[model samples]
Target: MQNGVVMEETKLEPRVGVAVFVLKGKSVLLGRRRSSIGDSTFALPGGHLEFGENFEECGARELEEETGLKMGKAEYLTVTNTVFLEEPKPAHYVTIFLRAVLADPNQVPQNLEPNKCDGWDWYDWDKLPQPLFWPLEKMVRSGFNPFPSQSHPLHSC
Candidate 1:
């Protein structure tokens, strides 16, 4: 519909994501995005995967970038497939989830990216706050546990 020429809608490709489930004292870290796609929703510390970066590297980088906290060795946890078809700019992402503890338990989290995140807090996985980001909601619905050394964690949320 531009210059009397009919144009077809452009398609969007799925983006890859890496999210870290930072566990501390039986609670996981969650942050509320401010002006981004999933505004007002609680999400983990994560971002788009950069080329040539592994999941652990991406998780650590994103955690530091967003919360100013260093992430310890991240363990492969699970994955989520979420499609934001209801968004103004419908998009899809295949997010890889990783579990990590803080490199230093005494180090507190700070809001490094105020424009993106409101703040960070810890919440129990089973008692997560409402209106979670789609990727996380999907993962929680699947009952994927981030706890360590638990039998049947995959079957228990």
Candidate 2:
């Protein structure tokens, strides 16, 4: 080896994540995450932010990718910096949160990626399902109200 030393091949860098806070009436759209860090926990629709992607674009793309429902232009909501140091492989992510109204009221969320998500469902924001993903849980605990006015849809799935 050069200089009688070895170098690590990989570097640990913080990743950018985007999550959408979609609300249907008093309910918010969330899915059960099947990830290594926060497995079996409920989380908003989101994914990694790709290179050269703006926050809004990344949020929209990830939302549609995770859930078959499309959304109109997104609006900034909040952000969360979470570090999973206790996990087997420590990870860090800066998650930018956005909220968007459903573009198509008829477009129901489908389990497109069953491998990464158990499924999607609508849950009351105040009474969310247990074991929330870290970022989302942090947002909830902060008492942040993304939507001041809740649209109580006459019918929801």
Candidate 3:
């Protein structure tokens, strides 16, 4: 059964991505995904981290690409790991979070991949967008913030 038999192959390790919460004072940014990837719908400002870049750097780069905002000051927030498992587990992802402030709040969002996402907006903390992505909602519940130039690595705020 040459056609019916399954082929064996090596699997690559999971890659890491960084998501940034671009907070302008009391407001936070959220984006709407035009396309769907399984159950993931709306998502925060984030994407895969490139080689030789730090987590914070990746966050800043992704924010600019997705929202057209130049980050002022971004601080480390938190990180998470996720695995996509259906009938067969295909890929795993490690995500890092950073909280950044925008240099200009008035700037409009321009999608890096216009075919993938519709647009973005700044929403109050109390009101997260509808059809929200689970990972982002979880991050919101964590109550994390970027403390201004504290000695400690993890900010208390």
Candidate 4:
């Protein structure tokens, strides 16, 4: 310790996040974020990965919690490294993407957490909503597509 002052270690680590790409026909589910991090931007049904949870488990839990939809089989998509340089909190996240079909084909998406999201809606992949969340924007920019037949080269586990 310099000058007898104790130094505390600063903990700065990339947060692990799980995002679900729920597809219905040629459309994908998206929600308008109302949270402070990415307010007013469209994002997937996702959240931070809880302790002791795998990617699929986290994706299923987040999808149900955020959109009130039952999660079916989730396939691993791709990982995105997101850095929010413009945000007030200045956060970093390593988000794992997963594609899941709804357990019930007729199930509707809802905004279960009003404080964090506005509502869920479906948008065509070729024409997504404006101002996407950082991770999602990155995914789109990298040509990531949930539709396996689109030839994006994403594999399911």
Candidate 5:
């Protein structure tokens, strides 16, 4: 406690999330959410972080779980804190992005949860579909490449 203020550490409440940019040479993978939640439209391949998990582990685990590809070394990227001004019921989220290359381009990503996700596809950076996730669009706009040799530090390990 400093300045007569009680500095209690909050429980955090599972506010951490991770998104991985699965790269396949010249393409990035994007999945369509069939889930009632989310935008129910466009979203990246990621989910909530598990208990006692670090950012890298969460990112790699989520990527493989959702995309069926093991992640190699992932780069540390800037974390974005999202606070919904209107929704007050624990709407805070911190998202970490990482660059991951596909282990096999020939293997297709199956819908592990068919009820939640319809399918997945590899999209060229230059040409992406409309109504993508806002953060994803921003990532593309900010020139975040998944290619390691040329990707930014935030994109590569």
Candidate 6:
């Protein structure tokens, strides 16, 4: 309590989040977040990593949960240490970036969680939507690319 006002005592920890890069040709799948944090901003399909889940498992789960599309497999791309200092509830996250291909090229993406996201859309890497989510914006600023390259190792089955 401060100045006779009761304050909730909550533990703050860096949450582990997975962001999947689902590519189709030159476009990548993105969704507009509708939640309190990063509201109305384009971001990759992903969410927090559940307990007892590996990076790949988390990525696959988030991808399928957020967007109605099944990914073949995901490869580790990079990680971002994000810190939100301006939000009402400041938070930190260790965001793991993964790349994957759609199981079916013709499979369309749908908004599975309307409460958290608006809808899914494919955008070219060079022409992404404005107001990107924090992690994704940081990734672009750091020169991170999701395109398939021979330089980076891929994990596929």
Where does model 3 exceed 4 Å of error?
A: 1-12, 35-40, 86-89, 141-157
Please, what is the TM-score per model? 0.87, 0.86, 0.77, 0.87, 0.73, 0.91
Worst 10 residues of 3 by lDDT: 148-157
lDDT agreement with native, every candidate: 0.85, 0.82, 0.71, 0.86, 0.70, 0.87
Our model 6 lands, by Cα RMSD against the true structure, at 1.8
Instruction: Residues 124-147, candidate 3: write the lDDT tens digits.
Output: 777767777666756657774433
- Candidate 2 lDDT over 1-157, as tens digits, reads 4587886566779998988888777788989988888999999898899989988788778888888788864677767888999777889999888877788867799988999999999998889899998777777798877664547322221
lDDT of 6: 0.87
> Per-residue lDDT tens digits of candidate 1, residues 1-157?
9999999979799999998889897899999988547888999999999999988899999999999999865688888788887877788888988888888987788899989988999998779998898778876787767788765332212
**Candidate achieving higher lDDT, 3 or 6:** 6
Candidate 6 lDDT over 1-157, as tens digits, reads: 9999999998888999988999988899999898767888999998899999998888888888878798886788888888887777889989988899988889999888999998999999999999999888878898888887777655762
Q: Which stretches of candidate 5 lie over 4 Å from their true place?
A: 1-14, 35-37, 84-90, 149-157
Clashing pairs in 3: none
Stretches of candidate 2 off by over 4 Å are: 1-9, 149-157
Please give, for residues 1-157, the per-residue lDDT of candidate 5 as tens digits.
8799999876645377898877776777888776434445567788888889877788878777776767765676566667643433436667887766655557787666666666778888778776676667666687875565644433345
Residue 20's lDDT in candidate 6: 90
Q: Which scores greater on TM-score, model 1 or model 2?
A: 1
Q: List the pairs of residues colliding in candidate 1.
A: none
